[model samples]
Each structure stands twice: as C-alpha cells, then as structure tokens.
Target: MLHIPTWKRIVIWGLVVLGLVFALPNAFYSRVETHNDAIQTIEMQGSTPELVADRAAWPDWAPATLVNLGLDLRGGAHLLAEVQVSDVYADRMDGMWPDVRDALRGARDRVGTVRRTDAEPGTLSVRISRPEGMEEALRLVRALAVPVATLTGAGASDLVVSGAGDTITVQLSEAEKVATDTRTMRQSVEIIRRRVDEVGTREPTIQRQGTDRILIQVPGIGSAAELKDLIGTTAQLTFNPVVGRTSDANTRPEPRQKVLPSLDEPGQFYIVESTPVVTGEELTDAQPAFDQNGRPAVNFRFNPSGARKFGDYTAENIGSPFAIVLDDEVISAPVIQSHIPGGSGIITGNFNIEESTNLAVLLRAGALPAEMTFLEERTIGPELGQDSIDAGRIACLVAFGAVLVFMGLSYGLFGMFANIALLLNVGLLFGLLSVIGATLTLPGIAGIVLTIGMAVDANVLIFERIREELKTAKGPARAIELGYERALSAIVDANITTFIVATILFTLGSGPVRGFSITLGLGILTSVFTAIFVTRIIIVMWFERRRPKTIEV
Candidate 1:
C-alpha cells in the first residue's frame, strides 16, 4: 500500500538534487556574481587576464545565472519622463511648408502670389492674394495629404486643410495626431533603452508608464541627473546649404530657408536651406576624436544611401558653405574645399573632451523622436538597500527557526521529516528564482516566510489523519495510505486557490508588489511538490526499512 515505483522514486530524488545544485551558487553570492559579471564583460569587451581569471574561478557546467536585484536592492537612479508628443506636430508642419508652397506656386495664374502668414507652431497659414481661387488652393494643399496608417485613425488623412476668405489654414488632423503620438512614444521607449544599454549597465528597467510617460530605473547609476544628461539630449544634427551670412535678425530668408544664430558667434546668423541634405538619422557610427587643430571633436560616418547623397551634394556644390545645425542652432558653416567621397566628417567646436565624448554617445544611440520633460527623479542609496536586505534576512531566519521548532514539538519524528522537506522547498524556490533570474525584494522575502508557515501545515494535516486512522485499529501502512489519500483533495484545493490569487496579484501589481507575487507563486508550487511527493517518499522509505507493525503519529 505504501510502495513507490522505481521511476517515481528516481524522479523525486532527481528533482531534489537539481534544486540543491541550482541553489548552491546563492550561498557564495558575491563570488558567483563576480564570476557572472566577468563572463559578460569578457563577452562584450574581449577577454583580459583579470576577467579570464574571474571566469575560471567558476566552473562552466555550474549555473552561472543569478537573481537580478531590483533598483531598491541595488543603488540606482529613477526617472519619470513625459515625452512632448505635440512637438512632432510642429516639425511635421515645418517640413510640409516647401511642399505646400510648391503646390500653390504651380497654380499661381489662378491663386495670385502666395505668402505664408503667422500661425501656431503646429499650423500652416498661407494668404492667397486672390480670394476667388481659394477652392483651388485648398484642393492643391489637400492633394499632399497621406492616409494615417494606425488602428484608431484608419483611412483618415494626415492633415486637415481649411480656408477662410483668402487665407488657408492647415493643421494635423486629429486621427493623424493620435497615430503620430503613438509612434513617437514607441520610438522614444526603444531609443531610451538603447541609450541606457550602451552605457553598459546591468538590468535597467525601461518601461512605458502611460500614453506619454516613460519610467526609467537604472541601478548602479550615480544620480538621476547623470541619467538625464545621458538621455535627455535631442542631438538632432542636420546639414543645410547656407543661403547667406548676416548680422541682421530682420532679414527675410528665402521661401525654403531659415535664419539661425551661430553658437560660437552670438550676434552672427546663418541663413540656411530648411531642407537638410542629410541628417543624423543616416549616421551609422560616431566617435570622439580630435580635429587637425587638436580640439575635441566628434567624427561621424554615414550609411550607404547617406554616403551617396552626401557625396553627390559635395561634388556639385564645392566651394559653397554648408551649415551644420544642431538643435536649430548653427554649429559651423564650413565651405566645402573638395569633394568628400567617403561620407565621413568631423564636427569641431568649443567642446572639451567630455562634451565631445557625450555627443558621440548620443549620436551612436540615435535621437529621441520627441523632447522629454522630467516629472520625477530620485536616487536610492546602497546603504538603505543593505539595511532592507539585512532586515529581510533576519526575518526569514526567525520565521524558519520558529517553524522548525513548532513542527518538531507537534509531530515528533514526522515533524523532523517535514522540516527536511521544508528546507528542500526553500532551496527549490531559490533554485527556480535563480534559473529565471527573478528580482528579489523585501516583499519577496516576506512571501517566502509565509510559505514556510504554510509548508508545515500539510505535514500536520497528514500526521493528524494518520493518528486518527491508527485509532481505528488500522496497520501503519494502511493508515499512512488512507491519510495521504484523504488529505490529497484538501491540499490541492487550498493550494490551487492560493495560486490563482498570486497570479492575479502578479498581473495587476507593479514593482515590489509583483516581486512579492512572484515569490508567493513559486512558493506555492514548491511547497505543494515537497509536501505531497517528497515528504511521502521519505516516510515510505523509513517505514519500509523499520518494518514497524504499529507507529505513533
């Protein structure tokens, strides 16, 4: 009646051994963590003697994975940034100016001379000198509108063009604005992730908080300001043909050009073409270097299409000054002395080495789709995290010791069996955690403590059931079998209900709450296995070896 098949025996013991093996690395936490970091560094930056030595200290066959600590455990900076999604609308309108002007100019005979008027940043206002041709002017502008390819904005045009008397006003349609905002937010998240990853930090959390906000938590960072400096820069670089240089702010630029102030010379301005020949979007690589004058500079290389376009522009426009504009300010307007074929150039300014290096980093990471305004920022200290870890460790030990004593005093030998199973259950929990690389927080530690108390409850139920069966004059084997059989339904029902609750917590919660749910869920699984299978195996083997005719529960 108490017999276990050879296969089941092997499976149960095999799982126990695997759990202990996987859990062993946590005992040597610092050493194993160093080894893991060394391996990753070697893989990323090639192997050095120090890295090789550290990696060699840990065997390859052993589990190298460790639980990733959260921002609270590791010292880090956290930031909540809201992307200015409306910024893209202004840019879209600015870019469409040339197209609108060209289309209106084609119908000059009917619409008279077209002049752009003052309007909001996201709107284009043009005055058609002849009011009779307003319908044709509106038609020409609407021809440029494209369909918004988004779920909510399907089959909608990108722009809404309206006319009032002789004036035409154009702005982004509501559907198109929604589509653009969604795209901008998604691209912002991806670029932020790349920027943080390029800095070589371990396990940074870059997630979207809502429609327009992003939550960034990077552990081991010095301060939130440092992270903001790394990611906040737009770094929008463009090369526009210089229309002319002047000191007058009132000078009207050409229809397809604009005037921008020089960064190096405050009063001087450069009138440049609004359309760029090439932008930073084409850049494939950027690195910090020194110019011929030994000044800190950033060197950039373009991709194939960008290289070809740049080469053609330089070849045809040799001796013409081209302005390098960054963030709407003129950095330099250097004259092209020769045809540059390779699509590589250097940007030099009054930059120190650090500024040049940071510029290079931003270029390599690509530009954000929109500007970000920081809403919240904070730095978590390592000392506070250490205190939390210390408190959690003490609580765990206290709960564990208390449960062991309580179980031992209540069920005697069977209690000792349950204690061994409980120890293995905890080991299995850690083993699963390490394998999945889950983050352990203070709440997670509390979940494990709760699990310890729950783990013993099963053994108490079984022992009491066995005692009840013994009172009915049943043999030790039959009483144990009946006890396990009777208790199986209760154990399954209770644990299943608790597991569902844990799942709901994980789905609905964030951060520390989710961490607690993870440990609670894992604990439920391990405790159930240890209680129903592991403890039974130990009891069956003991009873068979002792050949007891009657036993005290």
Candidate 2:
C-alpha cells in the first residue's frame, strides 16, 4: 500500500483547488480581442458587461495597465538624441552674474562708450555699433570670465565661442565630454519619459546609449508626425527689440515673413532654430478650450519667473505682433493688448480637437532639455505581431508534446500520472498570469514549455526511486515514503539554482527580457507545488483505492 499522512494529503489537494481560483478571471477577458471588443458602441446606460472599463474620461487612467503592448507589436514614432553638454556649460557660464558684470566692464573699456546690452543668465551681450575693437574686447572678456579651461580648450582663438553673435566657442576634452554627455543623457531621459507619459503614449521606452545619445520607442501612437515635431522642436521663445524701422525686416527677401523677429511691439515674430532665449522648462500647466469666437485655443501656465519675463515683454511691445512659431511654422501672430499676469496666458490658433488637446500636453510637458536627433525609426504593424504570436504558440505546443510523450514512454503507468501533473502545472501558471494581469510575450510562452520539462523530471526522479525500493522486496507503502523523502532534496536544489538565475535576469535585463524572466520565475514557483505534493497524493490515493498485485513501472 502507498501511504500519505492526512495533513499532507490535505495540503496537496489544497494546491490543486488553489489553481482553479487563479484561472477564474479568464471568464471576464478574451485571449485575442479586437478593437470592437474593446468598445461597446451600442452599450446601454445600465450596469452591464458593455459599460465596464469606462475609465477613458480619466486623464490619469488614459494609459491604463491592462493594455501595454510592445513597440514592434504596434506602430509609433522612434527618437534618438545626442545631448549637448557644451551648450549646457556655456549657458551656465554666460548666466553667471560675475561673468556678465565683468563682460560689461570689458565692453565699456574697449568701446569707450557703452551701447545697449542684454546680459541674461548664461549669456553676456554687448550691442555696440558692431564696434571696431569689438572682436579683441570679446576675446579678452572670454579669457577672463568665460575661460576655455572649463571646456575643451581647443579653438582658433583658444576660445570656442561662435562669432555669429560675437560669441566664443570652447571645445571640451575626451574625458569631460564623455562625463557631461552621460549625465545630460540620463537627465534628459527622465524628463522626456515624464512628458511622453503625460501625453499618453503607451509603454514608451526611453533609454541612454553609450554616452551622449538616447533612444525612445513608443507603440500604437496615432500622431507620429506631431510627436516628432514636439520631440525635436526647440521651444525657445525670445523677445528682442527691432533695430531699424519695424517694416524693414519684413521687406527682406531672405526672411520671408509678414513680421520680422523683434523684441519691440512694432515688429515681433517667432523663430525656430536649435537655440532659444527662453525654453519651455519654465511652463507648469496647460489646458485646451475655445477662444471667444469659438476658435480652438490653449491656456498655458508658466512659472513665476517665466510669467514675469512674459509680462515685461508684453508691456514693452504693446502694439507689435509676436509670432507663435512651432518648428518654424507660424501658428499665430497675436498683438499684445495688455500685459499678462497670474502666471498664465492663452493662445488662439486655428486648431482642431486633437491638435489643441495635444498642444496642451506638449506645453505642459515643458521643453526637451536638449534637441534629440533621430537615428532610427522602425514600425511593426499589428498583423505581423499577431503572426509572431501564433507561431510562438505552435512552438510551445510542439515542445510540450515532446516532453509528454517521452515521460509516458519511460515511466509507463507512473509516467501517465506525471503527464497529468504537467498539464495541471501549465494550467496553473497561465491561470495565475491571467489573474495577475501579466502581459504575455513570445519569450514568456517559451518559459511555459520550459516549465513542462522540469515538472516531468521531478515526478520521474521520485518514481524511479520507488522502483529501486520495490526491487529490494519491501512493501509498496514503505518504498513510496522513502522515495519522496530521498528525492525531495535533489529536486529542491536544482530548482533553487534556476530560481536564482531567473531573479538575476529580472534585475538586470531590459524591456522584453524582463517579461521572460518574470514568467520563468512564476512558472518555477507553481511547478514545485504541483510536482512534489500533488503527485504524491494522487499516487497514494490510487494505491489506497486498489492495491496492485504487481506494481507498474
């Protein structure tokens, strides 16, 4: 007779029943649901299956958990970035009050008569008549205040400043460049991820490359072009005075715009370039609504400092028009009627429902810390993702079949019981996955097949030990108990190593790798329970019901 203690028998039975609870949630969901399945178009107002999952109205729930698909599985935009550490350092140096005050002193010394200058943070400005000795004075100032020592000090004048606006450019060394690049890329990744998340791009992957570069992948994104513009656009707005008559800039053939770029009210326009006087980092919130005439508009709120700068701009250029240029296209050019305060203002542009809503999202997300240049863009349609999924399932089926047939051939009647246990093991794993809401991937399916083999091996080891005991001519019950006690240590030791390896993979791997690790980890846990305890109880029950004259192999 085969023997199992009453408490031990209950424990094994309890595990089998527990698997049913894990699988029950499947009744509410489908394995392959279409877009129509997602929405109940004709759903009645009452409480029904159709009215469930109506959390769309909630912004926080816009990108809900249940539906996070991969990049290739869905279509979306991709982005690559190379952060400008030199630019960041230059901005910091130019903004220093000591540097700005010193540059002002040098300008007075060289020109003998100081003209107007705009000395903002991170930049020193000296607007003389483009003076005779202006070049030398700037050289002297750069050497004193903005030294090439802090940057890559190789330049024509030993100062790496651009003379485009009488600015010196300094180059950085290999070491300084590498460190700065890495820091900027990491910080930029965090900020960009937050912005994209707010915009509701599903499961966007933002990661850092070797040093200065970054990669972003988003799936199921409908507005790839708009997202591209938002990602790449330097949302830098500046206000500067019109040097000559306001109308002269507009007349210039090269810069073909109704209004020329100006700080003054009389001639103001927005310019799109890699640079910006004020970045969107200063903005806080944004909302969408219709203007007085029912035109689509966005209400954007800026930080206190940004609001003050904007207010001063409005007061100085009351009658002139300022262009709202995004990616160099003039969205609107509104004249300032009065100063804007309270840290918030509105923009009226000819926009539709979606565009206006997205603009608000972009503005609220603030500006990208630096421009990100795209290196690669790969799009995978849903048709291909579905095909891959189908193939993966077929592979799993084949693997399981092989494991089952081999186990039954080797173990005879005992192998048949092992096959049943393996089936239960797989059902329990998926049932737990579906209930816990883990997204299934191709690698995850592979983890299941791997679980099948391990489950069979556990049973075979125990049954083989029982056969060895029976050959000693002892009673059937004594052999069965000794078999379980002896094989338990070996089975646990093998599975423990695998569990630790899965844990390490989960910790270090990225994206899809993590999904496979998670499935393998969960599969390992479920396999141990069903294999050791459940199989023991079933075999014991068989012998208790009817003891065999000759034990099956």
Top lDDT model: 1
TM-scores, all models, native as reference: 0.81, 0.66
lDDT of every predicted structure (CA atoms): 0.89, 0.62
* Cα RMSDs, all models: 4.8, 7.5
Residue 62 accuracy (lDDT) in model 1: 88
Report the lDDT tens digits of candidate 1 across residue range 1-553. Answer: 8999999999999999998898899888878877977877775446889998898878888887677667877778999999999999987887788799999999999999998877988998999999999999999999999999987888899999999999999999999998898889888998888888876666788889879999999987889999998888888889999989999988898776899999889899999988788888899999989999999899999999889989999999999999989889998889999999999999988888777876887888788878999999999988878887888888889999999999889888988999999999999999999888888877888888899878877778888888888887468899999998898888889989999999999999987888899999999999999999999999999998998987876
lDDT of 2 by residue, 157-197 (tens): 32233344533333333444444556567667877777677
Query: Any runs in candidate 2 off by more than 4 Å, and if so which?
Result: 1-180, 191-205, 216-278, 289-296, 303-325, 329-342, 381-384, 412-417, 431-445, 468-482, 506-516, 533-553
The residue-level lDDT of candidate 1 at 251 comes to 89
In candidate 1, what residue range of length 10 has the lowest lDDT sum? Answer: 37-46
